[model samples]
Target: MALLGLDSALGATLDPVGVVLALVAGVFWAGYVLTSARVGQLVPGAGGLAMTLVVATLVVAPLGAPRAIGAFGDSALLGLALVVALLSSVAPYTLELSARHRLPAPVFSILLSLEPAFAALFGWILLNQDSGVLRNLAIVLVIIASAGVTLTGARRKAPAMSVEAAGTRRDDA
Candidate 1:
């Protein structure tokens, strides 16, 4: 709702299909994070990630292979593919696995919400895509919301931990 309101305030109309796709992506990302955390617990991090990439490649191959074969004739395109794969997939997945081990799920999810702001910044810097003032304001709103969630969550957890500690001490006494 806030996102929709922000879009309207920015004088941008939402495409229904794009909105639906974004929602669907959010669901998939939630699933990914939860499953990755479990997988990180059960299997060696790199091994599990290796298996995941292999399965992902197999799944994507039918659609991507034929197009890639045709496109791979261009050496520059091949280089771009390799760089994109490493930068977008390899580095991020590895870091995400490490983060999943360290961060609580809710906090992690809040952190994930900052991706759009980073994307906007990267687009501006790397692709020369300029977001106007209203759009930049929308990005700032997202960052503030994420920070609010994270700080509130941390405060909530601190009390719970202290309560647990008191309970343990009482039991020992």
Candidate 2:
């Protein structure tokens, strides 16, 4: 609903194909989170991430390698690619794997939803993309929502642990 409202505010029509692609991306994201968490539990952090990246590169290389090779002649593009790989791929995966070890799956997933809000802020600041008040407010709301869930969820677990500890004390007594 917030998306639809934002779209309406922007005076933009929704593209069905784009919406379907977004849905597909969301499903893939969910899969990535669940699989990453399980993998993080089973395998060591950096090793699992390195294996995942190798597989991902192998999967994508056939399609992208030709174009990438052609573009490699440009030193600026090569530098950009290196920066992108470090910032967008390596850093995030490392942090995400570490987070998976520390956070519950649902909380991590809720935190992951903050990506769009951060993306919007980056786009506005970096790319000079849409600076409309409504769009900015929507991004703020997303950040607030994600933070609210994380804080409230963490608090809820505290009481349960306290209750369990209290029960254990009574049992010991």
Candidate 3:
């Protein structure tokens, strides 16, 4: 945030609603990591993911169904939407489910936080979207920090010193 010139919000006013929504999103994300991991463990293969997505679609459809129904009238648009859905939403979730099955929950969740950094990197490389130097530095810092944390979490407690190293040498120097 400091790198984004957020160190000083000279004229900024807090939006309570936005703050609440962001907090809510964070809580939901935490829940998602845990729930997804459990689901992955319980259901082998993509069966769990498929069932979860189906339920999610049913829950979400009411909100978008009307607009979605209209979108079907244009065959090309419908095709485009399907492509977009598969590429952006479904594929990532599938990969996440697969990852959740394999990785430790905390490591998996921490790595997921790198999504924005990777997205920005892709944008810079592929779309010619240059995040300014400070923002770029921030992204690099975040990646480094995430990696450090993940590795640190995986570390065991300090090992007991070998007797030769911890004890005095028997011979004179």
Candidate 4:
């Protein structure tokens, strides 16, 4: 919605600000997940998530309606946003961070291929953004292809004495 508003208000098809927002979002999210896992190493379960939300709320506070807080107090849309945020942002972040600590990056990335499917399912259920069978099948195919790459890459036998301690290292033994 924010992106749609920006695109419409600016009369822009594609713009740097939008591109930058997307890039920054992806970069920060990747860092947030990886760093959250590291922070978990230092803290404990959900501590990193709590800290992330604290910082994120601080950053987004000014952008959220301060004066109209009472307006959203009983809004179904606001409630939906809160629920979606919990599921899409908070839950996924924690799960990905925890998984990144255990799974190889390629494996994790491949596992993330399922994200679109879940998102689509949620969109259909939550927002009624339903798609036809062909579109859904296409999405499934893409996910399967991505998973194939991840699985094949993870299964590759790497030579010994090659940065074995890294999280991305293969357990080829």
Candidate 5:
């Protein structure tokens, strides 16, 4: 929808290369989520966040380097970019990975649907982007829906733990 909106409002057309890049991004991100979830299970105590940053840095550098590196000298500019990276990359990655631990992959994808709402809200308050009562309400609706689905799923999974407990033999047995 956002892409459609951009196409309609801005007359922006994606070339074949752009379309391919977008598709590649979607595929890699899906893999990243699944791989993070698997690693999260193995490490037991480690956050999937560090892996996200590591992968992101490596991926972006090769594609974005000359221009991205050129802007790095000024402290103020560097700080701004770092702040954006943390907010856009770090927080969302952590939230997604943490949610993945308890939620099914489909449910995790649902929670991710609310991220645009957050981006919109931030843009409105910080950048004075256009926002109105309807937009705010839409954001609220997405958040509530995501939370309801996540919590309900968590509750359902909780009951399954009893089955595992029942399987454990007592020392007296």
Candidate 6:
């Protein structure tokens, strides 16, 4: 709340439009995380991600394409845009989905919860931005909570696998 400056006040937000929009975005982000796991499972390699990017582009292009098209006429601007997209969006999403595929959902979510810490850290280090005590405390709290969840929240026995499913006969081994 302190950062974007209040999805919630000390008691209430009074339903400000920015807070409402942010809440909606939060809900959509949660859905994206959940669906990204399923997409990783159903599609091999980056195919699912590729399809997602294409669909997202088609959906948003109507809003952005007219403005973006002019940039394409400049080789330097187009190259910078591609670089920014690849570094900021594509690579992170790819790695996030790859981790989501391997980790249990709870663990993945907890790990993702450290996003604020990472963002703050980057801002501090790369941009020389000062994060005040609240942000520092938040980073510490998030790390501790993530550690606790990893240690306790995701416990389970591995499911038994048949040898054929494991891709080897006992005799062959």
TM accuracy, model 2: 0.73
Q: Is candidate 2 or candidate 4 better by lDDT?
A: 2
Q: Candidate 1: deviation at residue 67, Å?
A: 1.5
What would the TM-scores of all predictions be? Answer: 0.73, 0.73, 0.71, 0.55, 0.54, 0.73
For each candidate in the order shown, give its overall lDDT on alpha carbons. Answer: 0.80, 0.80, 0.78, 0.73, 0.70, 0.79
CA error at residue 143 for candidate 3, angstroms: 2.3
Q: How many clashing pairs per prediction, in order?
A: 0, 0, 0, 0, 0, 0
Q: What ranges in model 1 sit over 4 Å off?
A: 1-12, 72-76, 102-111, 159-173
Q: What TM-score quantifies how close candidate 1 is to the native fold?
A: 0.73
Per residue, candidate 4 scores C-alpha lDDT tens digits across 1-173 of 24344434455366668879988998997996577657868876677777878898888888876764875877887788789889967886777667877887787777777776887798999999865565577677777888887777666755445464653555543
lDDT (Cα, tens digit) per residue for candidate 5, span 1-173: 34333443455455778768988988987896678767887765434568657866997788877777766777888899889988878776676666777777656667687776878878988999875555566667667777887777778877554655666644336
TM-score for candidate 5, residues paired by index = 0.54
Off by over 4 Å in 5: 1-14, 102-107, 116-173
lDDT of 6 at 58: 88
After superposition, the stretches of candidate 2 with alpha carbons farther than 4 Å from their true spots are 4-10, 72-76, 103-110, 141-173
lDDT of 4: 0.73
Clashing pairs in 6: none
Predicted candidate 6 versus true structure: per-residue lDDT over 30-138, tens digit per residue: 8987787688878998899999999888898899987988997999999999999999889998898788778877777778888888898899999998777665776
